[model samples]
Target chain A: EAAVTQSPRNKVAVTGGKVTLSCNQTNNHNNMYWYRQDTGHGLRLIHYSYGAGSTEKGDIPDGYKASRPSQENFSLILELATPSQTSVYFCASGVRGPDTQYFGPGTRLLVL
Target chain B: GDKVKQSPSALSLQEGTNSALRCNFSIAATTVQWFLQNPRGSLINLFYLVPGTKENGRLKSAFDSKESYSTLHIRDAQLEDSGTYFCAAERNNNNAPRFGAGTKLSVKP
Candidate 1:
């Protein structure tokens, strides 16, 4: 089975504080993604990386940034966290096309 | 406008009953994926289809590219099956998959 693990499974932050969520995949998939899940919006992609040192903005990337320092690790950074940004975040790793993307356990973030 | 739409936003089923979930795509999707988000909030991949049908145990899923739709059938539902089901469509190999609003399913014994 593909292994994808996320750090700080639950987090609480104050408004304007900086927060970071980390993901590590043992599957060695080239593509990694960060998504936030809200009540009705489902999962909205925030950022994605094709490989190490590469990051691309997704549909809703305004409040988030992503970093891929190595093939096995990806991180989502919130420079100025807000209550609006409070949601469940998921990280996934997969190959380029037509393949299964393994997801992490997910992180619950609450901004006050 | 939603690019991917899922029908019956919420559903309830009794134990040993069956249910079906549907997703319609407005985009020219080339692939489809079905996922079940368990109560613990883990997204478990159920099926990945490429314009065809695939069955795993009591769950069967079909993706029709020509029709721009996909369906998931759950048989003999169990309490463990209670969760949110989501379907995603991929326009092409290079583009990211677009997800639907999801179907929240509840199974009771």
Candidate 2:
């Protein structure tokens, strides 16, 4: 099984605060993704990276940014957090082709 | 409109029963993947398919690319199977998979 880990399983941030969610994968997968899950919205992609130093916007990327400093690490940054941004975030890693993605436990964020 | 839509948003089943979840795609899906989100909020990969059917233990999943649909069948459902089931579709030219609204399942003893 591919190993994916996320830091700060739970977070509480104030409005306009800077929040960072980190993800690390040991499987050496080239593709990594960040997604947010809401009650009605299943899983909406925020950003993805094909490799190190590459970041691409997804369906919902307006208030989020991603950094892939290394192949094993991907981070999601919220420059100015808001209440609407409070949700569970998940990190996933996969290969470049039609391979299955392995997900991390996920981080729960609350912005007040 | 939803690119990938799942039927029966919620379901309740008794142990030792059988049930099936369906996903319909409006996009030209090339591949499909199913996942189960447990109570602890962890996504577990259930099956990945490419226009074919695959079975594992009491779980079976089938994908038909031509018809743009996928189905997941659970036989003899158990309490441990209670969770939210999600299906994702990968388009031909898109690298990102579009996910459907999950089906929340409750298995009772």
Candidate 3:
């Protein structure tokens, strides 16, 4: 079965601190995505990568950056963590087959 | 306008009853996928539709491209089925997918 795993299941960051959330997938999928889920919003895309060395900003890309170093690894970075950026982050991987996407357990982050 | 809208933001039902959740799209979509987020916060893929209906176990889903809407029907609702459900649609013009806000369902004994 295809699996997508995330590191630091739970994180707490101080204001202005830098935070990195890591994701690794064993599915060999070409597309990977980062999303944040809040209380009101369902899930908003922050960044997406089509392949290694490529990244595209999603609707809510502000305050966040993404990196795809290889087919199996994708990372989301928060340059300066803020209280507003505190939310659960999810990582997903999919192929262009227009098929279903596999999502990770999600990393819960709290910025103080 | 919101790209994707889900109806019945929250629903309450009794065990063994049935209910339906819906998603309406404003951005021309080519593919649709439904998911169930368990209490533990894991989103589980339920169905992937291409303008047609698909059924699995006690769940069924249909995506209508022309009407820009999708429906998920849960039959014989059980306590274990209570969770938040989401539908995401991928536009034909791009790889970007817009997701509905999600419907929270609660099943009572």
List, residue by residue over A1-112, the lDDT tens digit for candidate 3: 6799999899999999999999999988999999999976899999998889999998899999999999999999999999999999999999977688999999999999
TM-score of each: 0.96, 0.98, 0.98
Error of 3 at B17 (Å): 1.0
TM-score of chain B of 1: 0.97
- The TM-score that candidate 3 achieves is 0.98
Best by lDDT: 2
Per-chain TM-score of chain A in candidate 1 equals 0.98
lDDT of 1 by residue, A3-108 (tens): 9999999999999999999999998899999989999988888998899999999889998889999999999999999999999999999888888788999999
lDDT (0 to 1) per candidate: 0.92, 0.95, 0.93
How would you encode candidate 2's per-residue C-alpha lDDT over A1-112 as one tens digit per residue? 8999999899999999999999999999999999999997899999999999999999999999999999999999999999999999999999988788899999999999
lDDT of 1 by residue, B1-109 (tens): 7889998899999999998999999999998999999998899999998999999999999999998999999999999999999998877845577789899999998
Candidate 2 or 1, higher DockQ: 2
lDDT of 2 by residue, B1-109 (tens): 7999998899999999999999999999998999999998889999988899999999999999988899999999999999999999988767778899899999999
